[model samples]
Target: MSFCTRFAPSPTGPLHLGHAYSALVAHDMARAQGGSFLLRFEDTDLERSKPEYVRQALDDLAWLGITWDAPPLMQSAHLGIYNQSVEGLTSRGLTYPCRCSRKDIAAALAAPQEGAPHAVYPQTCKTRSMVERGAGDAVRLHMDRALNQASAGLGFIEDGPLHCGVHPIDPAALLDEIGDIVIGRKDIQTAAYFLASAIDDMRQNITHVVRGVDLFEFTQVQILLLDLLGHTPPRYHHHDLIRDDDGKRLAKRDDARAISVYRKDGASPDDIRLMIGL
Candidate 1:
């Protein structure tokens, strides 16, 4: 396939230095390889996503001399597609409905079992069939069955300089680390972040996924998701994160380090590239 990558940011907060670094890296790599660089708005969280933040992100990215190959894609606008993915998975008998809240899950895992590794959801609703799904129920994958169907020895190739290797997807690690993760929400109108992102990458024909190393741990689950969906995952290039003065990775809440603030303070695009060590 032709080279393609994307920088998808949720429009819930300011685009920080980390965002700038990621976007620049994808853009530069795409250009250098004569590939397509896409900008997508991962505004699936309707409660927190805002139109103003979307506008701000576009303005800031353009001001930084970055451009996309096509018009930006809005995750919110494509809910139907994501919804279908949820339904498709469910119909395949690979997923079941869940009604447990975060508190319910916390209570379930509050007490540790003897010599058991830490896990997320305790499978409170794993036994519930789709016919028994209630009004407020979320949808979670039947991870064990999924792994069985996906077969064994699943892995992905990472081309990122920091941690380049053939990383194997351990099913046992997945069952313990990310147990029956929420694929679709209560209303079934949208999907989880990882689920939506995995589907987006598949549909967009992305050949490379360039993001931060902070996401390395989660790559395995996404790879498994893609495999279950019968799609080949793109090569990943997980770069290092840009840290703040205290050496903490920057978050969207770091408004002081936002690209807009830097622009307002007369920091040019070249200055940003230099500051981010591009």
Candidate 2:
């Protein structure tokens, strides 16, 4: 495949410095490889994602001198594709309906055994079948069963400075680490971040995934999903995060670090590149 990468962002809030860093990194990598750079809106969260925010995000990227190769994809408009993926898993008995509320899950975790490893989902809905699935109930992937069906030694390569090497997946560890994670959400009839993003990565023909190191831990589960779905995982480059003066990661709440604020304060695109050490 000719190198291709994407910078997918949720339009829930304003674009911050961290978002700039991530987008610039991916764009730069694509340019360096003489390949394609794509953009996508992870707007499945209907309640949070807004048109204004999406519009502002586009302006911010353009102002920063970043250009995407094609028109961006809106995930909300493609729920059917995600549903098709969920159906494939459901048909294979690899997914089950989950009705556990956050409180219910917390209570279940609070009553866990002493020697339990990862404090992830306790599989409260492990035995629930799709026939019993009610409206609004979340659908979770049965990690163990899915792993069983996946090919052995499933993993992806990392080119990031922090963890630069090939990573191999451990089936047993993923069960405890990721557990039976939700593929379909309880709040809406859309795919969760992991499933939707992984599906897009495969379908978009993305050869590289560039994001913050904070998300590196969950890469294995996505890789597992891709392998189970018979698609190859992409190479990942998890970059260091941009933090505030207080050593905290920049968030949407931190308007002081928002890209728009910086732009309005007379920061040029070149100034941003220099500030972010690109």
Candidate 3:
């Protein structure tokens, strides 16, 4: 298959140096193989995603000389697809409705167990029957069943080298580290990041996933979801994250580092590329 990659960015804030780096890297990778590159807008977070931000993000990418195949795919416009996916999982008994709020989860995980994240979920609603599942609840995939399916004689071939941190193609380690994660948000009917992303990748037929290392852990969840949903897992290359002088990851709130601000300061595309070492 021809190489296919995407630079999916949420339109919740202005694009920053980190966004530029990720876009350029994915663009270069696709161009190197004479493949296709797609631009996807991850606007599932309705509370924050704005039309102005979406326009600014597109402008930033174009200013950086990154061209996509067609108009970008916006997550908001695909709510029906996401709903269908959720229904599929729910109907198959692969997902259970979660009613626990943030405080409830926090209180439950007061004591963290070994090998679990500090904000580990105690699965308070895991055993709740479908009859009690309500519209206000979030959908959580059955991790144990998904993992069992993922490890049940599953394998795939990568066209190129797999480079994600220190480990090399350690699928077992990836699964063990990443437990059950949210696939659908309670507040929003739209799919959560992992679920929407996996579905988008599959629908777009993305051959490789290029993003920052911060998302490396989430890849395990994605891989498991794709396997359970009968979709091919794309080859992944989780690059090092862009950090500030204080060794902190760049965030959308860093207005000073936003690409729009840089543009206003008359920074050229080459300047942005140089800044991100592209």
Candidate lDDT scores, in order, read 0.89, 0.90, 0.80
Q: List the residue pairs that clash in candidate 2.
A: none
Candidate 2 residue lDDT tens string, 175-272: 76668888898764788999999999987889999999999989998998888778989999999999888888988888888899998899999988
**Which of candidates 2 and 3 is the stronger one according to TM-score?**
2
Write model 3 residue lDDT over 1-278, tens digit each, in one string: 99999999999899999999989999999999999999999998899899999899988898889999867999999988887887777777777878988887776667455334355466778887656777788888877666655645454433334442332334555435454577888864778999999999999999988888787656666766777787868887777778889999999999999999999999999998888777
Candidate ranking under TM-score, highest first, comes to: 2, 1, 3
Q: Which residue runs does candidate 2 get wrong by more than 4 Å? A: 112-119
> Which residue runs does candidate 3 get wrong by more than 4 Å?
111-117, 155-177
Candidates 1 and 2 compared: the better one by TM-score is: 2
In model 1, the number of clashes is 0
Q: Give residue 114's lDDT in candidate 2 (0 to 100).
A: 29
Candidate 1: stretches off by over 4 Å: 112-119
Most accurate candidate by TM-score: 2
